[model samples]
Target: MFGSQPNGLSTDNKMLSFQMASDKVKGILQLKKYLEQFGYLNYKNSKNRTHENDDDFDESLESAIKTYQLNFHVNSTGVLDKKTLSKMAMPRCGVADIVNGTNCMRSGKKNHHHRHGSGSPFHTVSHYTFIPGNPRWPASQTHLTYSFLPRTRSDAINPVDKAFQTWQGNTHFRFTRVQDSSNSNIKIGFGRGDHGDGRRNAFDGPGGTIAHAFPPPDGRFHYDADEQWAVGATPNSFDLETVALHEIGHLLGLEHSEVEGYHVSLHLYWSH
Candidate 1:
């Protein structure tokens, strides 16, 4: 659901003002409810504090905000100002809406093939031929890249990585982890400076487009800076492993499907 602002208001100032208002009044409670649903808010921390209108952002809360901003393509400033808040108020593409027969999942009739020297919708596979440090591909080969933000919990990465590896079994491709700036490849910052998700638009709707990745050879993926990724069931219901796998599929050139059947018939009919 989208919200409106008063007349004669500056677009930039509106998000910050709305956030302050949301923090104070219950008029725009959806955003706060969504955050609590995802387990970003710590009830214990607020127990003793009497100021309900103030955002007592801690390290974890800061992390959650940053993650959300990065995924939504907003500036990851880690400050919940007006711009970020207004973006958060926009409508999100719901999971059910993306399932099958939805506008979000529709694709054209074109078939994207990863042939040698041929450009296709599969950008990751095509870029492999030009990657400077990569070994030369076979005369005809296709490759994919899966990039994402690392979970704060070290334990979460291994299992999620293994799941992705298993999902790609027998495919002619390689996977690598993008480390922090210290490693020199491409650094991902969690909640500070360019990596922070404090912008007002972060996580506005449906957790604000959790994360995304570039196709292979390019090999760059990013996650929302404002999420509290959890391993298992929590009150907020964040599923780190599941979300990672979904985004990885996108990096691998798989678009969201429409109930998985529309294209199946086409494939079978064309097999002859």
Candidate 2:
């Protein structure tokens, strides 16, 4: 489902050209969107579209691949090698990795004074990060009331409960499940594709994006119902507790960490 422009090389050891057939444009477009969404690539100048509506591998895409490689500690080559494709295929949260074009995950930038520096997203910090604005719950609002909406899965109930407990055990925040979603601090449920938040926040199917959560004050948590979800120790299905824990982290004002090999992006069934 993927092709590479591995042959393209520039005089200065950069990728000036690459290999891609017009026939492979479809998959490349998918890859393009993926990179754009996660913040590996962007198009600020419409006039300078490197690909230029064509199907060939271009400089823009190569740069995006290079950024992704740098983030994931892969080889700096801009080529879409087999390892790159394998990493991209992993299931991950729907959250954007680069908030406002600033990467939220990358090692060696450690700061203990603040989680996010400059009262904005950019931070010279450690592996774990927070949202752009660092929107955390109020100090007085440590106890958060949570509720499950109509599409809440039964198997997810216990796992979600356990996840909340895990959060409470570790942090000052406490979560309580309630029957009222309207008044709840966090609302969680299942949805498929464009559930309600609009097309921009739609779920991409089972393996691409398993779940998404809004930061503090906007407690909209959603899971892709099309996924094969399990409670615990189930084969060939993603564990609800695992994803629930990651999503819960978002609700508690934490963003995805830059730690290598430790992420919410995984298809647990791969080994099984």
| RMSD to the hidden true structure, all candidates | 16.0, 8.6
- The sequence of per-residue lDDT tens digits that candidate 2 reaches over residues 109-212 is 32343343243222334235677778998889998999999868787899889878866755578789999899999999999988998786898765777788
lDDT of 1: 0.38
RMSD of 2: 8.6
CA shift of 179, model 2, Å: 0.2
- Candidate 2, pairs of clashing residues: 8-17, 109-125
> Which is the leading candidate under TM-score?
2
Clash counts for all predictions:
23, 2
RMSD of 1: 16.0
Off by over 4 Å in 1: 1-104, 108-153, 176-206, 260-272
